[model samples]
Every structure is written in C-alpha cells, then in structure tokens.
Target: MFKHLKSDLPASVVVFFIALPLCLGIALASGAPLFSGLIAGIVGGIVVGALSGSHIGVSGPAAGLAAIVLVAIGTLGSWENFLLAVVLGGVIQLVFGFLKAGIIGYYFPSSVIKGMLTGIGIIIILKQIPHFFGYDADPEGDFAFFQVDGENTFSEILQTFNNISPGATLIALIGLGILILWSSVLSKKGKFFQLVQGPLVAVVIGIIFYNLTKGSDLWGISTDHLVSVPVPEDASSFLAQFSFPNFGAIGNPQIWVTAFTIALVASLETLLCVEATDKLDPHKRVTPTNRELLAQGTGNIISGLIGGLPITQVIVRSSANIQSGGRTKLSAIIHGFFLLISVILIPRLLNMIPLSVLAAVLFIVGYKLAKPALFKTMYDLGWKQFVPFIVTVLGIIFTDLLVGIALGLLVGIVVILIKSYQNSHFLHIEDKSNGKHKIKMTLAEEVTFFNKGAILKELDSLPRDTYLELDVRKTRYLDNDIIEILDDFAFKAQERNIDIHLISERGMVENPPSFIEFFKLRPKSA
Candidate 1:
C-alpha cells in the first residue's frame, strides 16, 4: 500500500487538516477533555490504520456517538469510570471481530451503498457551507439534524449567509480558485504540482491571509474562524492530559451496560464506514471488514487505556483522504503522525490557519461525492435504483448517517421483494382444446422464498379442469420453500380437477407422483 507514497503523502496532509477540527469538536460535544479527542484521533489513525486492511479509510473520534458519550459520562459518575467502559467496549469489539461478525457489511445493497456515498457527499457540502462563510456558531464536524449547540443544520447555514465575514469569504474564494486551477491546469505541468496538492496550497494561502489581514479592520478573520488545537502551557500540563481507566469501576453493572452500548454502536458505525469508504475507493478495492473491526477494537483499547473517546472509521476524514488522492493506508497513518506532532510542536502555527480554507477543501470533496452525473446515472437505471438512492440522499441530509442508511436499506429490501415476485416468471395460456385450457408457466432462472407468494398466487388461480405445464428448464436453483408450495398446490390441484406436467433440465414428468417427491428423486442437478 505504501507504494503510492507520492499520492498518499499529499492526501494525508489534506486529511490531517480535515480531521483536526473534527477531533476537537467531537470531544467538546462529548463532554470530555479537549485532549481526549486528539488522543482518539492519533490512536485511530496510527493504531487502526496500521492494523486495518483498508486502502484509504481513516479512523477517528466519531460525531455519531457524541450524545451517548455525553450522557454515559454523567451516568458513569466520573471520566475514570467512563474510561473503564471504553476499555470493556474494546474487549467486546475484539470478540466481535474474532467472531467474524463483519460479514454483516456484505448484506447491505449496492444501491443503498451508493446512496450512502451520495448522501454523505450532499451532507458534507451542506454541513460545510456555514463554516465556509465563517460562521463559527456551530462546532466542526457535527452531522446531526439538531446540533449539540442548539442550531439546526439548515438554520446555521442561513445564519452564516446573513453574517458572512468579508475576510473569510475572500480567503475561501481564493482557496477554491487555487484548488480548481491546480486540478485543471497546474497538475498537468510537472511533478511539482502533483507533489504540492491544492489543499496544501489553500492552507498556505489561508495562513498568508491571516498574517496579512491582522492589521486591516475590515479584512481580518477572527480567532473564532481559525482551526482550534489545544496547546499545553508546560511539559507537566501536557503529561496531565492523559487519563487512565479506573479498574474499581469494572464491577459496576452500569459500566457493563455502557461498555456494551459503546461496543455495539462503535462496531456498527465502523462497519458502515468500511462499506461506504470501499464504495468510494476509485480502485474499487474491498477492505477486510473483520480485520477492520479488529483494528478498531485495538485502537479503542489503546485509546481507553490512555484518555480518549471511542473511535470509528470517520466518513469526513476518509472522504477527504480519497478526494485528495489518497491511494493507500499510509495516508491515514501519516495523518495520525501529523495530529501527534502538531499539538506537541506547532499547535500555535496550526491555530493560525483559517477554517474557511479547510471548509473549501471539504467543498470540493463534497462535490466529487455528490456529483450531479451520479444522480443522472442512477435515474437512468430506473426507479428500482433511483428511489432508494434519492431516499438515502434525502435521509442523510434530513436526518443523520445511520438513520438515512436504514431508510435506504428498507427501500432496497422492498424493491428486492418486488423484483423477486416479478421474476417468478410469466404464466400464459398456450392452447385450448376439448373444452380444456393448456397453461404454460416458465420458472425464473432461480427461485427462492421471495418468489413463494407469487408462485402460490398463480397456483391458486389455475382454472379447473385445465392442463398446467410448469417449466423449470431455465432454473438453476430452486428453494425448498417453493418446492413445498408446489407440493401443497399439487394436493389442491387435484381438488380443482387440474392436470399437472413438470418440465425440468433432466426431462418432463407427466402427472408426477408428487412435486416435492419428484424433485427429491431427481439428482440435485436440477
């Protein structure tokens, strides 16, 4: 994976910028020490990324579980007790990974998976609009419908629109222009443009603007608009940031419950992210979800052993990595190092970089994810794919990540059922002779439980005293449930005075002893 160092390094820088504010904001929302979020980010990047099978996924403190973390900390009586729960949660996740529960990620539909990417893209674009305009009212990386800060996502955008900062807007526009120019033209010039990505350029420009505008009354972006990284005043203060779990709390039943909750939620969130990120991977690489779970478990264990919140594969950072041209997990690990070094050495310098520029970087990432061409392509595939895609998009934008995915999955399942019913094949009358009807029904290539209802309907609707021919010559596999449906129908066919003929790959059977018995007698070949 490290073979793509040229691409990975630049991508990692972009992800570092993207993940920085998110770590702090998520920690602030979780009601934990500011440094705890940084610890999670570092562990998630270095520990999880190193152990994971993913090519481009970046793990960190997640915004999805902020509410739960906030409430759990209070219920656990102290941060130390919460740390114990986090540790136990890591153990449970390790068990889950060993159990290979990650196979659940495969059950999600492709339509829903694509929808998740599109939805997240739209959400990123929508959520970052406020930050782009220099509205610092809401914390960074909050993807909820209702924010912990009491403002709705749309309302905050409106607020930002009303009170745009001149300096911030200028800097954002400049950053966006630089990104566009580099991607469109400068990138083709030489390796220099390739090595120095647009996002890095944007950051440099943002810092220059910050320094250049400090004395201008109308052009200065305030400290509120800058990236916020916690800076320790002294060596002892830095050492004091680490928090250890209290082993005495292990016996508490409530701690166990919290532990289970964190493990369950964090694992689920991580798996979902794994699916989404793989879909986003331009190489179409598949990550080993089980290994990802193990990596996340190890990271959480390490994070909890020190002082940090639970970690998961975060979409914002992962998406940023991909859009910035990350081709390997090296980008993720390197970003972790960036997080570690920044706080310890160059935090004040990082604080000088404006958030608007980072927001600009995210805007481009969002555009790529939710590109309009994607919607057109999905629409052309017909409603079966389009409806779920749009629903997932709307759900993520209107609700939150997990909820939107669930909604899309529900819609996808319903579409599958409908398709299954339709695929049971067509029934048509072939001939009528001597006051009797000859009916032919061609079975689909594969018939499963989903087709049982449709098959039963056709069986029940046959005319009395009719000749019915069931063709299974095209079918490669037949479910036992459908076979039983045929058996039950055979008894009823006799009652309705209907003659039955079965056609299969082997040969034709006229008036078989029993549909179930005949299928059983045949070699499993049919």
Candidate 2:
C-alpha cells in the first residue's frame, strides 16, 4: 500500500474533497442527523478500506439507502431505533459473505453493469440541479419518484426554480466557472494545477466569494444563499449531537423488516460498486468480493453502533476515488480519517464552504460518469447492449436505481433467452444410397428446460423413414426436463422407421433402449 505513497496521497486529497459533501448529503437524505452521515463516511473509508482487498474502491453512505433509511426511521419512530436495524443489517451482510454469496456479482451481465453505472450518472446530474440553484428542501438531493415531503422529483425541481435564491445562483455560477477552468484549462497547464484538485479550488473560491458578499447589501446575497454548516459551540456541545439507539424497539417486527431492507439494498449496492470499481481500476485489480462484503458488513455494524447511517461500497464515492487517481486502499482509509478529524477539529471551517462550491465539484463528477462519449460507446456496442443501457438510463431517470436495474436485467435476460432459443438445434439432411434420408441433429452445448420448445420443434420436423444421428458429444449438461423430451422423441422416431444413433461422451449407442435409460447408464465397473 505504501508503494504508491506519492500518488495515493494526492489521490486521497481529491477523494477527501469529493467525499465531504456526499457524506453530509447522504445523511441528510436518510433523514438521519447530518453528523451520522459523517460518521458512516469515516467508518467506510477507514474500517472498510483497511480491510478490503480493493486497491481503489471507496465506501460511504449511499444515496441508494436514503429512501430505505427515511422509511425505517419513520416506521421505527426514531433515528436511534433505525441504528439498531443498521447494525443487524451489517450482521446479515457478514452472513452473506460467509455463505460465499458474493459470487452472485459474477453472474450479472456486463451490459447490465454498465447500464447501472450510466443510470446512476444521469440520476446524480438530475438530483443535484436543485441544490445547484440553492434549493435545500431535501438536504442531500434525494432523487425518488416521490419525496418524503410528498412531492415528486420533477415537482421539487419546478418548485426550486420558482423559488430560486439569487445569491445562491450567483455563487453556484462562480463556483462552476472555477471548477471548469481548473479542469479544462489550469489542469493541463502545469503539474501544480493538476495536483491542486478542482473541487478544492471551487470551494476556496466559494468561501472567498461568500465573505466578500457577507456584509454588502447591494450584492443581494441573503443568508439563505450561504452554506448551512451545523456548528456546535464546544466539545461537550458537539458530543451532545450524537444519538443513541433505542434498544427497547428490538421487539418490533417492523424493525426486522427495516433491518432486512438495509442488508439487501446495502449488499447489492456494495457488490455493484465492487464490480464497477474493478472495471475502472487502471491496474485491472480484481477485488475479493467476499472479503469486501465482510468489510462492508463490519463497517455498517460499527457505524450503526455509533449512531451513524448504514454503509456500503457506494459507486459514486468509488468512482470519485478512481477518477482522483487513488492507487491504493490507503487513500480511502486516509479520507475517512480526515472526515473524523474535520468534524471534531474544524467544524467551523467546514461550515464556511458554500453548497454551490460542492455542487460545482459534483457537477464535474456527474459529467465524468455520464459523458457523451459513454453514450456513444454503448450505442456502438449494438442493440443487445444499447437497449438495456438505454432502458436503465431512462428507468433510473424516471423511476429509481433498483427499479432501473431490474428493468435492465429483465431486458438482458430476454436477449439471452432469445439467443439461446435461436441456437438450440442444428440439423443436416442428405440422401442416402439405400433409399433413406441420412439426417444429423446436434443439440446445443447445454440443453436446459428453456430449450425444450426449440428442441421439440426440431425433432417433430424430421421426415418419416429417415436415418437420424443425435450428437451430444459437445454438450456438457442435459437437464432432466430436456432428457424427457429426447426420450419421447426416441419412441416417435421408431414409429416413423427413423433408426436413431446417439453419440455422447459415454460412447456411441446405436438403437438405444430409451433416451432416459440411455442417459442414466453410467460407465461399467472397471
């Protein structure tokens, strides 16, 4: 891990800047105390990162869990009760790791995974628009079809536009300008500019702008436009902000439901992030998925015990970690440590940074994830890939993350089944010298129940009095259901005077007793 100290240190700075607002935002979205998000972010970075095998993956409070957390808090009647559920969820994730369930990540298609990443990119851009314009109704810019405030995502955007804050808008514009200049111009000019992250520059500029406009009545920048950084007067006061769990609520069945909800959603998100981070790693390092699951589980457990939101390997944070040039897990660990130290030692300093500045940072992030080039590349991959990719993007845009993925997966499975059906049967016919048609049928590599219809159709199409050869040499698996179909076809072939020859790994059998009985025959004792 220390091999890339120079690279990792600089990367940690960029990741730290990227993580700061997301930590606060996700907590706010979860309907938990803002500090809880910070706690989770710290644990995700330090605890999970230290234990994880992933070189560049980062973890934190995910936006995907925001809705679940909000509902859990309400159903459990308190944020503390929700923490208990989060801890339980962590235990469940550890069980998933022990069971070796992390292999499930390998089954997801590449197209679906790409779709998920692209969908999330689009959602981030959409969700941040209101915050960019100074709308703070929902703290972290949660992008649900229906918000906790009883408004849809689009409705909230409209409402924000109608009630736009001028000072916030101006600050946002300036911050965006600074970020763009830093990325597009200064970043390429010199190594110094590249080393200095764009978000940090935007944030510093935002603070200066805020101070410059703080006392001027002519500027029209109101207090509403300023960053609402929570400030506690002293150490005792700050400690008072921490909330403990309501262990008494453990008896409630609703608590279990919330626990399962967190476990499942957090686990899925973590797995997806692990897969995505591996794809993005410049070194192509493969993360140990089970180990990652255990690490995430432990982090969630610790976070919940401390009144923090549940943690996951969030794609947004992981992507940020990679794009920032993180070369080792140390970057992630250090970033979390920074979160822990910042809230404890420099809360006031953090409060000085404007939301517009953070928005500018996220704007760049969103662009990197959902650039036009990504869309074009997916499109060029053909409809099989593009269809699911587009559906996922649209679904996530109109619905939510999980729903979009489900839709994409559904489309992806359909494509697979269609391809399977098309390739299930191969037929060849030639005229034999003995006044019989010589026929050959080659079954697919794997004949499952799904291939039954095609196999049956092919068998039924054979002409009477034809000599048939069935080849299963290349087939590795034959489902019982498909074997039954072949069994039935054998009797029909006899009736049509179609002499059958079976070729399999077991050996060639001419005039077999029955298809089912033939397949059941094992090698003789030898």
Candidate that scores best on lDDT:
1
- The segments of candidate 1 whose C-alpha lies over 4 angstroms from its true place after superposition are 445-449, 472-488, 491-496, 503-526
Q: Residues 1-526, candidate 2, lDDT per residue (tens digit)?
A: 7987766776787677767878877777777788888888899999999998889999888887888887778888888888899988999999999998899888777887888888777777777777788777766637666776888778888998896766767878888887788767888898887677777777777777777777675544565544544678898988887777778888889988888889888888888778878887889999999998899899988998888898989887788778777789998998988888888887777777777667666777778888889889988999988998888888887888888888988998999888888888788888784878899989877878888888888789888888889998877778889889888888888889888888888788887878788777743220
In candidate 2, clashing pairs total 0
TM-score of each: 0.93, 0.91
Backbone clash pairs for candidate 2 read none
lDDT of 1 at 257: 99
After superposing candidate 2, which stretches have Cα over 4 Å from the reference? 215-221, 248-252, 431-437, 494-497, 505-513, 522-526
Residue-pair clashes per prediction, in order, are 0, 0
lDDT of 1 by residue, 57-150 (tens): 9999998888889999999999999999999999999999999999998898888888888888888888888878888887775787888768
Q: Please list the C-alpha lDDT of all candidates, in the order they appear.
A: 0.89, 0.81
User: Whole-model lDDT, candidate 1?
Assistant: 0.89
